[model samples]
Target: MRTVHEVSGLAGVSIRTLQYYDKIGLLRPAGYTDAGYRLYDDTDLERLQQILLFRELEFPLKEIRKIMESPDYDRDRALEQQIALLTLKKEHLENLIELARGIKETGGNTMDFSAFDTSRMEEYAAQAKASWGDTAAYKEFKEKAKDRTSEEERDLGAQMMRIFAEFGRIKDTDPASGEAQALAGKLQAFITEHYYKCTEDILSGLGRMYAAGGDFTENIDGAGGKGTAGFADKAIQIYCSRRGAAANCSMEE
Candidate 1:
């Protein structure tokens, strides 16, 4: 076991930060010494390493806690994501260095700004965050899914896909039409019932994800047919905007 001071030296984390982590229930030492000093064992150190990795990825502490405390948290998966994100960061830095050298060689006349483009890194980080499920909705989802078997889970997923198939049937219609909007409402309610509380904000985010051209898009399209994911995203955006406006009106009243 290592004392708090020893951990601070070894991990390069300050004693105060470790104490704060303990206070916030983010990390608890393995035990306490007779003199009330914090004592951390190997397992505790391992958790701390995970926490530090998330921190280096710029995750908020609360989100990190939610992710690490999640029932579905997988250490190997987290490590893989961390390595991917870090590699992206490294490549980004290298690009900036190359751009700097170019500028220095050209007497600062280089007009190219491609190195400043961080869209790829940011997109990957967002995807990583979503995969980590570092939100209240994910926590609720974990609670709701904890007792389900694999077959049951598959059934639920298939049911959800049927909703997308409905979206596919209406892909040719205007997104703001009553039919599309109603379908969007149905999708929101279904998610709320089976997954988590699909608030307007969360639903809007999901809409974007559906059309983001990755697994979500592929799976949604596979369920609903071609262009279905984009159609659903459009409908969801309209639904969420109208709902948000109504909510604001109610608040004002």
Candidate 2:
């Protein structure tokens, strides 16, 4: 058994936070001492670790409590699920890096959607235009893309998709590394080339959109393999941050 202070120091959480967790029954103590001090056991510490992990993932307190208290709760299985989700997020970021690279090399003129359904390109374009049509950048994107032939669009889209796939393979790299940042820069350039100027304002909005679920997220995730959208969103935010632009890096959807 250990005191609240010991648990706090070990978990790196504040004494107040632990106290509150106990008060709220989010993490009750294993027992109390004769002196009225709170104490926790190994099981309590393990449960605390799970709570912290869920917190990192931004799960609401209530949601985390419910999940942890569920009769079906299995710590090992939960950890596996967490790992899979995090891995998907990492892959998503890597895909954005690759997509950005393609944009830099080809000036945002390629699209490789082999991993995606080819029939969905038109649908995606329509949805994109509808989503951002009111923006000046969307207008510019339409004008620039208007003259491209169907075959040209297909080829370009395919190439871009291939880049996203490459990112998924390299998702384990540091997001702030030269390679990651370079990919980020490429992504910004790609957006500026194909869509709009991609200013910090635009980039921030796009980042949120990528993280937000829907067709765009689906497109990137599908092409890049399950987590590309979130990954791209993070890379874009990092890229914008490096440029001293306002960036929202929250993973909350």
Candidate 3:
């Protein structure tokens, strides 16, 4: 059994956060100690790990609670999806790093924009469907994403690269600055408009994926500096968190 402080310290979250999760029934204690203190056993710890993993994925607390409580929820399947998404995010980040380094070696920006590798989208989609069955949200989001041609997606990619370049020009910029935060808001709107519905939980999760995961962290850092991604992620999080959604989403992926 572990005390709240010990568990929270290990999880890199505050004790208060755990208490709040408990309060919301997102993660309940396994038992109580002699002094009536919460005691977390192995089962609780396991659930906590899953909750933390989803939290890192930017799931609102409520969404995570629903997911955890759902009888059909498959932990391994969801974890695999999170791992794959994080891996893709990491690879993209690495590609940006390579591009930046290449520009440094060369005299100017070599405009070779083949950074995205999309040959596996079909296979991945098939696998996801096989694993998760047919989810309305997943199907809807993917279909929306499919409406764009590969070339259009590339243009969007280029537009984002341009944004990163601007961030590089102002690494020490304040996240709350009109320029930076405004751009952040623009990015949020863009995502919300095109890809998926921008619920409070979805927005927060996507924003956190920009930092909590290593691939996201590396991508944001490689684009500008260590600061830009952190700032953007925080700004987005704050914006989404204030909307009062508690991450109660049930999207397949």
Candidate 4:
């Protein structure tokens, strides 16, 4: 038998967190010593291991409880699935490293820049989930990323691409101008219509991303030539300010 402190130390979890878990009925001591101290046996240790594994995958506590009680639950099968996911992640990372090396060996960042592909960025994100210590938190973040249907994503992608293509032709355009603002309005509505129900917070965050990141910036800029994405960001900031909670993007009430 081991005390809660001993088990928590061994499991690399905080005592307070363990207490919360116990309060939630996620993992409670199976027995108590004569001194009224909590004690864990082998069964409790195994249960804790399962809980940790699920936590590592970023499964919500509600989801984890349901999964644990599922009739299809198989420990060996779950472990096998995790191992396979790890292997894929390793292979993907290796490929990324190879690609980076090739790009460096070739030349600098020109029109032929090798690292511009967007899908590579997506794959890198998937690999990062495994690379980071907490798979669960990453999973949670990813789940909230976007939940539009495949058809909706394709439609938005097509529409945005066309819009950018048109905008790209006008070099010195004022994004805050009425025409640009209208375009931004359409884009925001497109996001609301298709993407995960958006909020001002999410809309604002994405606007910042389009302006700042290499991935989003490049895609937005692809329309106008060099600075189109930045224009879109400015326009969006204004649009979101006007839209706010009415945008229906916020999960918050």
Candidate 5:
């Protein structure tokens, strides 16, 4: 685990900015020391890398959080878009460099200003953002959430956590057992009822996120007991596997 100071140094992000991120629920640390110092683990660092990439593409922090928190968020897809955007940025810079050289060589007589136009980059970014937000599941979630009050949202969140608390009670048993599988089904149904349709692919992605060692893990473990997130993830994996959806449920390190 790395301290906040170490992470700030390693990531070239100011400590104040990191603190602001934590405050805004953007990038939470893994844990805190006895003395109250924030500590980040490898998973946290990976999330930081994603945030940095999105920032490089000029995504607003609010948009970044929304995109990353989406159930359908795919790291590979985000990376591809980032690569494309960065390539465009690189090409734009090269054009500006060539333009500068031409102007210098022409003794400031060159009237070409096309190199300063960033419409292509701006349009591509808009399309990318639209694509991220255009998923059916995302649209459904927004529709469901649009009418919810703060109290209703909190109530739903607490109800879901209570399901994890149930998982905590049986976490020590075999995750593939009938009871565990039933609980996993219950959780899936709950998500579909309250949020978006929880397809096997989406559930598997959520399972990975639960044990990915960040706020989701911390919150689940807190609701249940220690290791509850991993237990639930295993149960979810087994549950999905039995239905021939295992191909989408493989856990990654």
Candidate 6:
């Protein structure tokens, strides 16, 4: 058994953090001394090690806790997975460093630029999970997408852009018109087929994102033409409203 102080020193985790983990039922001590000092045994230390590993992988504390407590939790398998992921991250960083060195040596202008072309969908998915860490929809999407090949995800993304381009071509149509509504239905079905369940509310949120003037807006415009994002957003709003769901795409008719 080890005191919290000893554990903190050996684990390189702060005593305060240990206390917080204990308070949250994330990492509890094995027992307490007669004098009331917390004592952690080997099993507790192993659990703490797992917690740190998950933390290093950028998993939220809640998600980490749920994963550790799940009946299917396998310590060795989890550690192996962590090692592989960290190895990939290390390799990615090394590649970036080498590219930087090459750019520095060559004055950067003659750079091949292919280093930036790496398929990083997994990295982006991790980031998205972190951003929407607690959302059920995000969790469902991640779960469903875990087995998808990078090439498959790329193809699906391309298909979605093509559909957006189709919307762009018909931008001048009335938002509630039959043509626009049919396209909106196709969009909803496409998302539901490839991603999460595209409820009306979710579709409306996506519509708002389409017109929010960032990467999504740029992609829509690039696909369908200028003003396509706004048109799609309005059409989506009309579609959702017609379905009697609350719509967040606030563009005027």
lDDT by candidate, in order shown: 0.88, 0.68, 0.66, 0.64, 0.86, 0.78
True-vs-predicted CA distance for residue 184, candidate 6, Å: 0.8
Question: Residues 1-253, candidate 4, lDDT per residue (tens digit)?
Answer: 8998999899998888778877888888989889977788999899888888767645578766665665546677455444433443455567667777776887744334343444433332333223233444334544644575778667768887777666565536776678877777666666665444455555555565565444556776876689876677677677777666455566564
Scored against the true structure, residue 20 in model 5 reaches a CA lDDT of: 91
Order of the predicted models by TM-score, top scorer first: 1, 5, 6, 3, 2, 4
**Root-mean-square deviation (CA) per prediction:** 7.2, 18.3, 17.2, 14.0, 18.6, 12.7
For residues 1-253, what per-residue lDDT tens digits would candidate 1 score against the true structure? 9999999999999999999999999999999999999999999999999999989988899989988998778998788667767766787799999999999999999999999987656765675688676578878988999999999999999999999999999899899999999999999999999888998877887786677555677889999899999999899999999999999999999
Per-residue alpha-carbon lDDT of model 2 for 7-50, expressed as tens digits?
98999999999999998899999999999999999999988998
lDDT of 6 by residue, 83-196 (tens): 645554565677878889988988886556655643332443243233334566766777879999999999999999999888988898887889899999999998887787
In model 3, which runs have C-alpha deviations exceeding 4 angstroms?
Answer: 107-253
What is the C-alpha RMSD, rounded to one decimal, of candidate 4? Answer: 14.0
Decoy 4 TM-score against native: 0.38
Clashing pairs counted in every model: 0, 15, 6, 8, 0, 0
As for candidate 6, its clashing pairs are none
lDDT of 3 by residue, 9-80 (tens): 887888888889888888888887899888888988888888887676555677677667766578886776
Residue 42: error of model 3 in Å? 0.8
**What does the lDDT come to for candidate 1?**
0.88
Provide the clash count, candidate 5. 0
TM-score of each: 0.56, 0.42, 0.44, 0.38, 0.54, 0.47
TM-score result, candidate 1:
0.56
* Model 5 CA lDDT for position 180: 95
Scored by TM-score, the top model is 1
For model 2 the local lDDT of residue 7 reads 92
